[model samples]
Target: MEEVQTQRESEQETSDESAQSDQDDNQPIVSPPTQPEPSYPSERLKRAAHMLFFKRGRVPGAKAWELKAGIGKSYEKVLDQLDEELKELDLQVKKVEAGGIGEYSPEDDEADKFRYFVRLRGTLTPKEARMSGWRIDNLAALAAALSLVVSKQGKVERKELEIMIAEKAGRWRTLTLTDTFLRTGYLEEDETGMISLGWRTKAEVDLPSLMMLVAEAKPQDDDAEAPATSSMEESVPQPSEEQSTE
Candidate 1:
């Protein structure tokens, strides 16, 4: 009887150990990473900066509901914070009046909206202004593509633009340039796959200035080609009048 009782006690202990082991296996092993709540102003500033960075065109600044829907907070506060941040970078939010291009009219409010325009602090070269935040090679490719479109009266077939770029850099490079320009707001595409100047180009680039730069660049390109052409001509054996007679 003593031996049977001891055997029953051992069995009970084994059963308890198994139950504890099952419970431990069912429990979660790893805790999730902690994410601290950001402050109110920081959240607002983050939204504004995000919009400015990613938005391809002008961001509607005056509409209260627009901000509320987009950022889930007050737009006025966000704009103020954004403006302050931009000032640190020598940039500013520009206010365009109503009836202007890309204007936004809110319900029951006819106030003008602000456009993201980086106001230059002082005299800066075009290359300097653009290269501050943009890739230099991409900018050059953009200029080349834009020149082609602008020469064709503000629009060009996508294939034609690609062919022109491919001449300088291979087909793969042309494709990359096209994608980068479209993403950066320097170019836009239509339903027909037509390429043209985008909203950012319309806002920032002056047409006359661009034309002047293109005009200046043409002479340099021609000068570069002259030497190559002259060399090729000299390499070919010309049939002289004496040789023709012989």
Candidate 2:
């Protein structure tokens, strides 16, 4: 009778275990709570803006590698985001060594070799340029210089360029400003004394639009009241801007 009692108790415990197992099987699983993804892009973008807009060290722009280190993986997307943000402010992000980048993705495996900058989306009005401390003679000299270089297939003798700019500006001013451009990275001079567009110019200037504007610019017809249209404004591939009469 004691042996029967032991067997009965063991059977009862087994039945209880089976019921508990069924209960556990029906219970819902509760996983650990997950953390939200961090939004680092906005903060990274601010860093990028400061790097591009402000002069750091000896340069006015930042390199892809520098930006990548500070912005994280595939930082070009952050630049794209910056570009979008800039459009509203009449500015845009540009990358040098990216010829015709508008038609395709300018970023590449060798992107680190390129540099990034911020530039005006629209041509600055004459008043704006002047108020920004731009002398008309200097502006004319620059327009003449870049236009001559572009017309010469992007390579010209240094002396020839100086002479071309001298036609717009005096010889002394030409020498002074040429050095300025060279030091500032707008024009590069090789050992052979050939002048070509520098990395900074490639980053900031639109060669095609510049050339077109120079080619199309002519003296306005003798009708002051005839609504003199600005060829510079028209040639530039942007929205029309009202001309500023100085």
- Candidate lDDT values, in order: 0.68, 0.79
RMSD of 2: 14.0
Candidate 1 positional error at 210, Å? 2.1
TM-score of each candidate structure, all chains considered together:
0.47, 0.65
For 24-81, candidate 1 gives per-residue lDDT tens digits of 9999889888997334567667766666556453533333445556776456566666
- Please write out the lDDT profile of model 2 over residues 1-246, one tens digit for every residue: 999999999999999999999999999999989997444457788988988999876656777878889877768888888888899899999877633222125454576666788998888898998998868788778778888888888899999999888867887788998997887677888889999887767877788888888878985566763444566566678644554332
Best by TM-score: 2
Give stretches of model 2 more than 4 Å off.
1-40, 98-109, 219-246
Q: What local lDDT score does residue 76 receive in model 1, on the 0 to 100 scale? A: 56
Candidate 1's displacement at residue 3, Å, is 99
Quote model 1's TM-score: 0.47
